[model samples]
Target chain A: MGQATEDRGTVHTVGLGKRYGSFWALRNCEIVIPRGGVCALVGPNGAGKTTLLKLLTGLNRPTEGSATVLGQTPKQESDYLAEIGYLAQEVPMYKQMTAAQHLELGAHMNKQWDGQLAVKRLTGLGVPLDKPVGKLSGGQRAQVGLAMALAKKPKLLLLDEPVAALDPLARVEFLTSLAEAAADAAGELTVIMSSHLLSDLERVCDFVVILAAGKTQLSDEIDHVLKTHRILIGPRTAETANPAYTVIKASHAASQTDLLVRLNDVQFRSAPWHVREPDIEEIVLAYMGQTKTEGGVQ
Target chain B: MNWAMWQQHKKQWMIFGGLIAAFAVFAVPTGMHFWHVYQQALAGCAAAADCDQLADQLFRHGHDANIFDITKFAVLFMPALLGIFFGLALVGREYNDGTNLLAWTQGVSRRRWLSVKIGWTVAITALGAGIIAALSTWWWRAGNALYLSKFQPLDFAVQGILPVALTIFAVVAAIALGAWLKRTLLALGILVVILLVVQISVPTYLRPHYAAPRVYTEQLVVQGNKNRDHRPDQAPVPAHTGAIWVNYSAVVDSDGTALNWVNPPEECSYTIEEASTRIHNEERSGGTPDVYIDREGGPAVHFRCLKEKGYHWEVRYQSADRYWKFQIIESVLYLALSVPFVAATYWLVLRRDA
Candidate 1:
């Protein structure tokens, strides 16, 4: 009986979609993020990154397909919502309320709110507890927003571009808080942070999901992506594809054909072209770019 | 949730507290002075030979009316202020600030959040509005006792349960607009317009017709046919008539049915009798008979003439005694009208994406 609820601490979706009027903000999105890993949801602007996060948080309902967060169908039910903590892109807080008041609000609103944790996080950041949050700096407000989400002690934390508006130092500080919270929770917490900034996501996220247009390009372990994808410079006379590999991107020079490929097999194959392991950023960019060349992103 | 809601209300609460203090400071003293004046007027009139003249003097004094006018206007717009703060800003400002994202994503569902908010807002609004209405009504008692003008629009709109109901309606309607429009300023603009129309139209068009009006049919007095004392075409209605006259002059038949003529008050019936000619002949084959030329032009119909013919001028008016009855009627009307706004607010908040 306990295993049923325990098994749900993960996110899995099949062909999930959200449409606003005639426009689909997110569609045909299939991603699987198991519990405990920090997943980076990277996309271009208006790429449905926020849409996917909102769907998982139950802030918005899906227009098509299904999404299960922590093994429960996302909805407005308190139990379901309690299991997931959501911070919107703007990191909205009652501007008139102080950080301490926000904690009080969180405690009143959530069943398992940890006021001490929130207080500690905010106080450590030198965010004044008594001043109204609107009077605080952008970084402080974002920290308070994070503390609010953290205090809930949710199994799944869905943050939508939480640090998008902060300064560079503030961005690092915000990410550091997230990393610390994830570490403190050990493997009991799963965080999905969406942003178009690759460097901000690269340090904290062990898992990655590349979304572009209304569709998801790739979802996998970061380490796995780094290991599987290759930059192969083959002869100019050669074709781009082979039966054994999937070419994610390809370009040609007069002397050589440049290709970014994901390995289909693990075995060491005698290939004609030289291979170089591509970094996560390069792989993400390649996948994101692969969609654009096919056209019709907007 | 309570703390957050309190944050929303903090500004309004402070302002309300200040208003209450001002009213207490001003109303109590004024009320006492008016009471003193009223008692003195009554005591002086007891021994006076002409109490009607003294009463008229008291009515014309309007001792408390000017000061009460401020309170009256304050009570009037207090509900409109509720529309701006509670109704229009309730959901609309949250959306405006992008805070609904934070709010709706809480462990509580949107509908529950809205339900709690609306409950708190409406309860407190009605309570505050009740206080204002009651205070204004109590303060105006000395003057109302003198004039009994509670049925008048200005008096009715600010007194009794009517203000409370109007306030609830304002907030609820504003809430619906906020939810539907999803913009604070726009919702406020529309809400103000709606409330303006409601306040003006409800009194001018709807309040007087809350119940069927009664007819005050005067017994006609007959003067001697030779004497015609000029009574103005429309008699001036007394201030203390204890009714709001919708129609001051209407001719009613013996059955008390109002005539639907172009001008009902001008309707009259007459007949030209045969002429009895008075002619004198000095010398003729036969003596001449007396002829009455009054037949050529008979006496014009006069008030006394019409009065004797079972025609009386009726005053159509809503009775002042039915003041509370109409208050209840209109209060129920406003409250019932607010149900749709409440429903729409809930539905919109629940269904719309945060």
Candidate 2:
């Protein structure tokens, strides 16, 4: 029901932009995501996804406008950062330290660190606590990094391509652990994970934010996006523009035209076209294709 | 967070601690022995006239010479190495390995994390260097009455609190440069080059001016080697006593005008090189070279002649009493110079992206 997806003031930003020299990595990005559930941050390579994550975590400050997480500015350290956790693309760790030592570091660094939870998570993954992180496999290291982040008991977790280095199976296992942790926390945890594997995201994410060319192309509940978009097959010369539907993308063959459109409470039976609900992949691809240059639909 | 960082960098601390232990092993017992020997050599000597001979015997036969010979170079570079190693380990490697991203994103603030690292590094470095300086200073003091003065460059840099100060100064410089470059090897390379230039230049050039050298003018004297046989021309007169540093010396006429040469009678005119060669030839041919130029009236008789003609000597020197003052002054200057680097490093770390 609507109560399940209702926002609890997770993240809010106003005209958030970050510029490096003359090039803007993320510009005028205005996005709000509800609390709870896994949020998919889908974007092509160099689509400013990592830039947005860095801004939210206070690793880098915004060049323009503001960004707030958990109803507090991200720049303030103790007030907001303690409630937020971040895992970067590299999954960096002290190579010389053991898995147990990383957890020890977490306990020492974080005031609210859950050492028992960290130990349980690592042991549950079958990762030996005494093995140095450098000697561990890539999958094991990623799990260690994830455990450390989760052990901080953060309200919001920001993961930037956390599973990019993992094999497909390992990716699933990692996401499964993340899902279990989220479920255990119930409504207390909100996750925003960026990934290129749209298929993997489809299974785990309930909300999606699609970014391209330094702009937000789409932001909505995944169920709503999947429910609102439909593929229409009709005549090659069909005039598709109307108040009931908005054309997101269109393609044509010799005798047929296929259009992906956003419906505004319109009945699909009134049109002289076959209507089918588009999957998340189809909707993401259609939206990404439309913004091949520097334009996107918010 | 600070404790975690310390644990992560414990290996680096071990290496630093090992260096300090090695220096202590080399210095402590040897220094105590030297101090004992020195006290014995000076005991009950009313005017300390025989102390020089006793000290010389100790230097030639005891461990003082060997130790001094080795530590002459050790004191110049140990502090610099400590600085470079600590700087690279503290911040440069973290940046290079991209671990700062992980470290900064933790619950701890970046500034707090960096402050803890810097604070611990500086404290350990200072403490280690302080111990080394104390041992070296004690050893130097034990023999200083009979041998080298604290005014010497090596002794000045290694004694008192200067070593610790210089070490801190180098570390601050290394941290700032590493923060700017974000590369460990590059920062270390530049740090070595900078420390080398600073280590060689400051003591050699800048230290002499710390206190104005006193000038003295007196009559020239004809002197000989320890055997008191051969008389040399243009020998400088001994001006100030004790371990004063002679900055400049020259032979002058009666009116205090500089003299290029002190000519003997024209009948025995010869350069000192010619006189020396002639004397060598005499020795080779089994002939007796005159033992006293003043008495025999050879070409070297010019020294005695100039003495008779009121030829004078002028010398510029820094007396030994100002050694401690200069050491304190240089240490203060080094500490003062390090402040800006520390400020710059903090500023850059706070503002840096990721």
Candidate 3:
């Protein structure tokens, strides 16, 4: 019932910058995300994640450089917006309106709405159609917002912590729906979700973009990032000797020292030293720390 | 566009329409009753023989039902409220509900969004104003016809329509203020302050001044013999007191004599052969009549009578002289007040962020 998979334009930027007076919300940030894949943007509070999303959605204009959504200028093209579904951080829905009303309003305005897909998604998420959004719980409200965004059947989905406020059960259900929705198109739908929940992003994100202090610390495939980085635990004396390894970061707790090392060369050998794959959380924190030490967040 | 303007705002429209309808139903009958009461008071004064007593009664009657009391306060207040509500809710609700952002992001430009909002508000305001105007006009027509026979329906132009237009302008201006401010309560505060200042200031300091004639009547007796057929020397009649004599005419020959010479542009003077002073109250019953004197201090052919009634006056002149100038001046003033509102609304909408 839908068109076959085709290549959509990548999310590309060149020296994109956003400034609020003297404070740089995001500056000198350049990154590229290939088409039709899931990318998670992980950042802490006040790290300009929301500002970056606003700029990418054209809700806010960039102070310098340029960013494109599907090869169209985000600020100028309204047609591109129709193809891009955005769920802002707060999910700005009419409070007095019901979930069904929000969906209906969105469907009426967007020509690309797929009624069957929307119905299936709503039912799957157990979102009450008859309940007014204001009367629903926070988790239900977030689900309603997600349903409205998905009803448009957009080519690119930009979600800002879509499940952050959800309960454990609701959060899992919400992410499952996202995975199913993306799977239905056979990886054709590209999703860029920003969240602080690394474990939740680990379940669905194929790519990870870690940002610290308004700049990109790391942006790569999840598998490549985990494979290229390792957590090495060795003696404090050996760590202090600075063995032959690209040390991303090293910290001492009691007598054991934890080293986050980039395994660019695996020739380093030390007695009683163990190497294990770095978890996504460790990799993100290491990059965050590195950015922090370099004067400020990028 | 249709969905955003109509469906989204349907409930608000229904509430506004019901309120306006209720106001109209209430105002029309009350306005009619006041008009009737105005007539009764005037008739009661006219029945008295003592001129001073009659004048005193007329003054009290005017104090009770002057233009400001009968028309301005009674008829214009409801219309102004309707206008304010129309303005406060027009764009204030959209910004509050966050639906405006949804509409803006959905390909509706900010200009188009504001246009639709202002268009709908103006349409509703015009309808509400038209209803109030029509109802008030009908009530005033019946009341004026019954009581103040001299009152013309065209007087509604001043007492009714002008205030309605002013109130409507206030409403549109308030709505624009609401959109620019983006908060209903703040907009309402600003609107109230501006309206209070305008209402107090415009009527007192800036209201236009209109020129009206003054009329004075006097009785004069002649001492000359009636049978002699002689023309006694006519004394110069002084000009009417406190009035400028623009024209002079005489009703000549109580006995069917055509005084063709007294008909044209020439001015005349008649003598006070005998005089009687009748005082009804404390003031002089018949004040000293002004004599129109010529250069030689001789009586002229014609004399003008002037009577002052506050801003308006009655004279030997036609009614058109008083009515036309007042109407034109008020209309121009009303038109001038409306321009700032229109210009401000346009500028605010053009520069407002989506």
Candidate 4:
């Protein structure tokens, strides 16, 4: 991926950290994502994914170093906030308020709120405007929350485990809606979503950022990551020693060994081995496991 | 934004508006009827020497007595209720329900949201309280001379600018507490307790200390048969009238030792018994007697003895003319005290986690 630039990047953080009573929830999290990049933040539970998202959205303030989302400090200025849309984990809404009323409130509260877009999306999805939000199904509520976020027409959209509570069908529908929105925007809207379901992300995201134990393990264009990481299955000691590939993970079975390695480019190096491109899920799992072995579980 | 906010909270606003409007409907007419009765009674007693007696008659036979009683009762506790209902529900419920996350993530800044909410609350509270204060004050004016003085605790608490000031205080206090606590019911409970303490303590303890009372010392006198002690030998200090609030009344020795008749000395037994007898007889004849006795004899004899022994009377009082001044001072004080609480709430909200 290209380096983060003030005008080109939608989000960048430098040594960003968050602490609660001496317990660092997220620490030393440095990340850079270019504008209009569909980034997927993949991490295990307690991997600071939510913390990072909160910081980016200005829903939270970093306890450590600075972060710039849309080239402004989080939670500092209203103008910057206006350009970002954030959907929290719970999808909280006023139970007594109808969907139409919520839209009315959004139109009132936001200077750049797109009322027509919000109404069209809701009506198209068959979400009744007169029904109270409390009476809606779980999937409907999440869609409503997503609609609220998208209606802002933000420069960047942050979703924290948006589909974690959805059923299998609902999960697909949610992702489809998000992917459709990103497609419609056509390289103008930057969307960063955090999810444990790596497969779902693989279908939608072009950029991948892997985090574990409050630290970022890998962040790059998804194509670049896929091209650099490879899985080798071969004999335990039938390889030439070279400085080309860095071993990320390895497992030995009797006389055979399976090795996951990161390299500048995938190539054969005169070995009795089988090399295959590692999927995003395998790469993320290797990185998360690597952090645990390195004792980064603070 | 203002219009949308009004639409969102219109239900709560309507409830509050309905309640206040209903109260006005009941209170205004009753107050007018009270004024009518009060005027008639005053005019009827125009030829009489004592207008105080005629005023008392209005209190006894007034058609608005029940309504006045209910309205005063409402005023006494309405501050707490309003604070808990509007203040806690406005912000506290947002936290409780976690809608603050949705709200804060919107384009609106947290500070702007709070300022608008507080501004609306203050305006609505002021409107409701202003109407109640105007109607009640107008009604009380005609009968004030016969009823309790404006300096009295109940009278002072619900009049002029105090109701408005108190409404704001209640709401701000509730907001601060709600922000800190996060739970609506818990915050409301604490608000009620705090308001109760404020309502009772402000009048009973804080008010009396607002300004130093005037000290009046007069020579002891002996009245013959004017008091309950009809034996013609008992006398005591009389309370001051015409814009003076009596805080304390006592007969003292030259050394300023407060004399006690509730626990009279051994030497005062004969005088006390004789005075008690005459007072009991007068009460049987449906007369209200002012009774006091000393160890020497009846009040007449005892006061003469007290003068011979170099005794006098002392009274501590607040002037009625300072009533408006005290009200203004108290309202300002309440509003000023609410500032830090409001600041603390804002700080907590700013620092709170999602």
- Residues A48-167 of candidate 1 have per-residue lDDT tens digits of 998998888887889999987776788887888788788898888788888888888888888888999899888899999999999999999989988999898988899998888888
User: Which segments of model 2 are wrong by more than 4 Å?
Assistant: A1-8, A234-237, A240-243, A252-256, A268-273, A290-298, B32-67, B141-143, B222-241, B252-311
lDDT of 4 at A115: 82
Interface RMSD values for the candidates, listed in order?
1.5, 1.4, 2.9, 1.6
Clashes in each model (backbone N, CA, C under 3 Å)? 8, 0, 17, 10
Computed on alpha carbons, the lDDT of every model, listed in order, comes to 0.78, 0.78, 0.62, 0.78
lDDT by residue (B209-272, candidate 1, tens digit) is: 7777776666544332222231223433534566353534565678877544333344332222
Individual DockQ of the candidates?
0.62, 0.57, 0.22, 0.57
Cα misplacement distance, residue A169 of candidate 2 (Å): 1.8
Task: Give candidate 3's total backbone clashes.
Answer: 17
lDDT of each residue in B1-354, candidate 3, tens digit only = 556467566777898688767766766666666567656765775676433243233324554447424654555565457556677666666666655555555544456666777777777776666676667666555343333322233243434455556656677777777677765667878887876776666543443234433333233222222322222223222342211222333323333232343332332334423111111121253443332322243334323321111111112321333444554565466557667765676676554433
What TM-score quantifies how close candidate 4 is to the native fold?
0.86
Q: Model 2: how far is B138 from its true place, Å?
A: 2.6
Candidate 4 ranges with C-alpha deviation above 4 Å: A1-4, A233-244, A247-259, A268-276, A290-298, B43-66, B218-244, B260-304, B351-353
Task: Name every residue pair that clashes in candidate 2.
Answer: none
Q: Native contacts retained by model 4, as a fraction?
A: 0.69
**TM-score to native of every candidate shown:** 0.87, 0.85, 0.70, 0.86
Clashing pairs in 4: B233-B298, B233-B299, B233-B300, B233-B301, B234-B298, B234-B299, B234-B300, B235-B299, B243-B320, B268-B295
